[model samples]
Target: MYVINKSRHSAYLLHAHIVFVTKYRRNVLGDLHLDAFKTSAAEVCAEFDAELRECDGESDHVHLLIEYNPKVQLTKLVNSLKAVTSRRLRNQFTDLRAAYDKPVLWSRSYFVGSCGGAPLEVVAQYVRNQRG
Candidate 1:
């Protein structure tokens, strides 16, 4: 479940579903790097006063459910998250880095969408829903 954040001027519960894929669609992520990746992403979120509520990913891409302040620009957050996480992940896993032909870990493109109105659980379920 998620909670609302309130300040002197406004109360909000803005959530962004962010997806980032590996460069050239390389399948390099594995179980060993997941925890480290999550910790690094959470740290990035903290820098911008956002909360990393949920994070999961397949071998080639990742999904982040982040609750953020309205004052934060969504694009900058995504860029930092990708930059920080990729740098850390690459630094931690030398083998994984060599596995890719390019030095960059992630691609230039990403997907981000906001959730609203519905209960937190429903929105979360929608994010976790599988595409068939």
Candidate 2:
């Protein structure tokens, strides 16, 4: 007789692709060092126990697709990411503050979407192609 194992359930995963834009669409993130900023953002994601799938953006906005555990709070994660990135960017690049034309690195609002049961590779590709 063969027995079935009903308790072997797959873990619940939540993939979130978030976009944080500068206030008033200012081009504070210069093209010369955009890659570095993306790297910093990825690091922040890792620190929060999230998989940084992809990070990309123009001078005015950033797009990040991250895979996080279901137990984490979405709002808390976003806020921490924004705070850390903003502080790091300001300290590393002084010109960013001057070019910001505002007191904030990221706008007060953000865009977040939940991707459930979708292949992570597909979501990563979409984020990577957001520049186009």
Per-model TM values vs. the true structure: 0.85, 0.74
Our model 2 lands, by Cα RMSD against the true structure, at: 10.4
User: Which residue pairs of candidate 1 clash?
Assistant: none
Q: Quote model 2's TM-score.
A: 0.74
lDDT of 2 by residue, 58-128 (tens): 88898888888655688988998888888878777878777665656888999999865647898799999
For model 1, how does the per-residue alpha-carbon lDDT over 24-87 read when each residue is reduced to its tens digit? Answer: 8888889877788899999999999999999989889999999999899999999998888888
Model 2 worst lDDT window (10 residues): 1-10
Off by over 4 Å in 2: 1-10, 100-103, 116-132
lDDT for model 2, please. Answer: 0.78
Model 1: how far residue 75 lies from native, Å: 0.7
| Residue 94, model 1: Cα distance from true site in angstroms | 0.9
Candidate 1: lDDT over CA atoms?
0.89
Question: Candidate 2 has which clashing residue pairs, if any?
Answer: none
Clashes of each: 0, 0
